[model samples]
Target chain A: MHSFKAVFKRELKGYFATPIAYVFLVIFLFFAGYLTFRDGFYEIRQADMRAFFSNLPLLFVFMVPSTAMRLWAEERKSGSIEILLTLPVTIPQAVIGKFIAAWCFLGIALVLTFPVPLVVCYLGDPDEGLIISGYIGSFLLAGGFLAVGTFFSALSKNQVISFILSVVACGILVYAGMPTTLDYLSNILPAPAVSVIENMSIQMHFHSLLKGVIEFRDIAYFFILIIGWIAACSIILDERKAS
Target chain B: MISVKELRRTFGPIVAVDDISFDVAKGEVLGFLGPNGAGKTTAMRMLACFLAPDSGTATVCGHDIIAEPVAVRESIGYLAENAPAYGEMTVAGFLNFICDARRIAGKAKKEALDRIVPMCAVGSVYHQTIDTLSKGYRRRVGLAQALIHDPDVLILDEPTDGLDPNQKHEVRLLINKMAKDKCIIVSTHILEEVEEVCTRTIIIASGKILVDSTPALLKEKYHCSLDEVFRKVTRTKKSA
Candidate 1:
């Protein structure tokens, strides 16, 4: 636990020590606002945060990978990984510590979008439960994507490759559950296979929570996805270190 | 205390650390001498628990490197080759991070930092980002980090690789000063370092130990300088 805090603090401070944190925050906020308002937030004629929350899965598919790409790849590239892993910290502690720090950073980014909900409340009477659930779902979605990005970051020593791989992986997860993709898959594949792929998509669970109904199954899906990917990351790093 | 038993590791078809074995008790400064790509760094890395051996296992401070890596790590300070650190972090920040990872905190953390910062001569660059510091200063910062926890064993790979002559002398002095109570393993091709600081010398070539003896005895056996002794043993190993 002590070691976890050490890694978490170092990684969080690392994000702010460079320009990456500020640049990411600005761009993320700009896009969140742009995508929210660009889709005619006011024109939708709903005083809820549906537009803001709806755009997050795709937005996080791109943004979370950028934040997570350097988590391990940069350490390997700079040779600091040797020093880091050699410390008393265990592999799981280091992986989860970094994952949570990046998750928290994304959480902060999600919080920055609070103004959208505030403005919704200002404009008209909005469903407060829906807004809260949307934020919860968004945070979980970012963690899900960040976990995949962290795994890819450990898989490759080059940050660009890690970023690209993460983007592709996260993109598939987001797009797999789209109506168009599921419809296309249902025509060729069997019902069970199509549902399996649909169930695996991050958008499905996120959309469930966005309905203001935070079901246990949806939350479990996100938790399982994040934990499974982070575990894979730890295994990859351990294997890489061994050979 | 450190012990190795036929420790072997390979990269695919090539053996990086062959079936080699040696041990260093506390208060012994073991100089690991070998040519480039001679498995010095690989052997040291295995001892540091950064890499696992393919066949055999080693133990540090009564903990096996493979079965008890975290325990082994907790008792050793490792300075990797080229002294890698977070470039964007200031010297102070980097050391503090190491302290934090080592579980040093509160008054203990402050005392550890206070002792290591000046000992490694990184006080002048404490506030500067590691990337902005000179090579000598960065190396010192890496040294400071390794020493922060005050572990029983020190695994330093090429500790003087980037230092000036004066800095090198100071580091040698530091090693000599600390050689009385800790088990130290210093890997370098610099023969003078072995003579100046190491109490015992192990020369390996092609992932195998060719000669393990004191510097004075190795020189006397070869009837020449330590440099000539290193060349003769390593060259003989290559030709044979």
Candidate 2:
């Protein structure tokens, strides 16, 4: 528990110490403001948060990778990873704490964009359920992407390699649910396998919540994948015990 | 406070630390003397519970390195050659994080902070980011982190590697002061440091322990100073 808090604090401070926090805030807020005010107004015919939420997963597909790719990669590069692993903490404790700290920072960046939907609510009678569901969906999608990034971060020592690997890996995860890609894949692959792959897509479940239905099954998908990926990360790191 | 039996480690085809055994009682200052890549770091890593040995076992304060790593880590403080620290953190913040991680809680945490901050001479740069601080200060912060937990054993891998003369003197004095109640095993290439800070010195060559003796004995046997003893022990001279 003490090591968890220490890791959590150190990681949170790391994000703030660099330009990482500002870059994330600016990128996330710009998309939300532009999508909700300028883009959504033209497409949805009303001041709704549909566009803001729709754009979130796509943004997080890139943003979350950028945020999480550095978590372990930087530590490994700087050689501090040895110091961290040697501390009186279990591998799971360190992994979960660092994961939550990064995810929570993403949460803050997500929250900063809330004013976009708040403006929509002020100007019209938007469905609070739908907006809340959209936030939940985006958060889960972000978590899934972060999970993939965490795995790739541990796979490589170089941050660039980790970032590239995570981006590509997460890109495939997000792409699996895209209609055009699935349509193309369906034509070539068997239907059952494609269906199974589509079901595993991070975007589809994320989309379910955008429509205001936060089902247990969809939530479970995110949890399983996130837990599995983080477990894989710990296993890989544990196998490479340096002491 | 520290004991190892037939410890060995091999990295693929390369033997890093081969078949080594030694023990240090409480309040013993053992200087692990070796050249670069002489298995000093590898042995220290095993003792620090950061790496598992390929064979044999080590116990610190009755806790096995493999079975009770958390207990072993809790009982020991370690400093690698580079003095590892998060460059983004402030000196005080980093120490606080380490202190917190080491479970120095409540008033005891504050007491540790108060003691370590100045004893490390890091009070003036408490708020300075670790990257911005000088190398000597960074090393001190590393020392401070190691001392923060107040463990019974300290494993310092090249503690004074990057310090000015004054800083080195101060660190040597600090180590001597702390050695009264704790077992401090320091690994270094500088033999004179062992003379100043350590009571017993062990030299390893090519992953094997070649010598373990007090400084005076080592000097008398070599018929020269500590530096010559280090050269004779570590020098890979071929018979000509």
Candidate 3:
């Protein structure tokens, strides 16, 4: 437990010690606001945060990976990984600590977009339950993407390659359940296969959570996704650390 | 405090550490001397619990490397090759992180920092980010973290690799001061370091031990300087 806290604290502080944190925050917030407003927030004329939440799956596909790319890749590149793994901490503790810290960092970014919700509340009465659910879904979606990023980060020593791999992996997860993609696959494949692919899509679970009626299956899907990817990451690091 | 039994490690077809075994009791400073890729770092890494031996096992501070790796790691302080540290962290922040990992908290944490900061001569760069410091300061900071836990075993691979003459002298002096109690294994190619601080020397080549003896006795046996003795043994082994 102490080792986990130490790793978590160091990794969280490390993100801010470099300019990467600031750059990531500024870009993330800017694009978030841009995408929301550009999607015709006024034209929709709704008090809900649909415009904001709708853009997040795509936004997180790129942004969450950026936050996670440096987790292990930078350590490997700089040779600090040798020092870290040699410490008393186990690989699983280190991996989870880093993942949680990155998840919290993304949560902070999500919270920074508070002004949009505040403005929506001031302009009209919005259902608090829907807004809360939207934020929760967004957080889980970011965590899911971050888990994928963590695995890719461990797979490559170069941050650029890690980021690109994460983006590609997350892109598939987001696009797999889209209506267009599903329709295309339905023509070529059987219904059961198409439905399996749809169920595997992260966006499907995320959309269910956004409706403000959280089902056990949706929550379970995110948990399984996050835990499964993190487990794979730990296994990879354990096997490849000596190399 | 360290014992190896036929410890062997191979990377693909190349045998990085080929069936080597040695032991160091308390109060003995063992110097590992070898050329590049001679498995000095690889062997030290296995002892540090950072790498696993392929076909054999070792014990450090009575904890087996493979069976109880975390316990082995807890009892030893390791300075890896190049003395790697988090470049973005300030000297103080980095040390505190190590303290946290070592589970030194509250007053004990303060005491560990107080003692190690001055001993490693890293007080001057306490607030400086590691990347901004010179190679010498970074090396000292690395050494400081390794000593903070004050473990019974110390595995340092190339502890003085990038220091100036004065810094190297100070480091050797520090090792000599600590040599009376700790079981220390220092890997280096510098022969004078063995003479200055090491109680015994082991020359490794092609992942095998070529010679293991006291520095004074090795010199007397070869009837030459320590430098000449090293070259002769390593060269003959390479030819064979």
The predictions' CA RMSDs to the true structure, in order, are 0.9, 1.9, 0.8
Residues B131-216, candidate 1: write the lDDT tens digits. 99988888898888888988899999999998999999999999999999999999987889999999999998889999999999
Highest DockQ among the candidates is held by which one? 3
Docking class of 1: high
Scoring each candidate complex against the real one, what DockQ results?
Answer: 0.85, 0.76, 0.90
TM for candidate 2 is: 0.96
Which of the predicted structures, 2 or 3, would earn the higher lDDT when compared with the native? Answer: 3
On residues A113-155, what C-alpha lDDT tens digit does candidate 1 reach at each position? 8789889989999999999999999999999999999999999
Docking class of 2: medium
For candidate 3 chain A, which ten residues in a row score worst on lDDT? A234-243
Q: Highest lDDT among the candidates is held by which one?
A: 3
lDDT of 3: 0.93
- Model 2 DockQ reads 0.76
Evaluated at residue A81, the lDDT of candidate 1 is: 91
lDDT of 3 at B112: 95
Question: Each model's interface RMSD (Å)?
Answer: 1.2, 1.3, 0.7
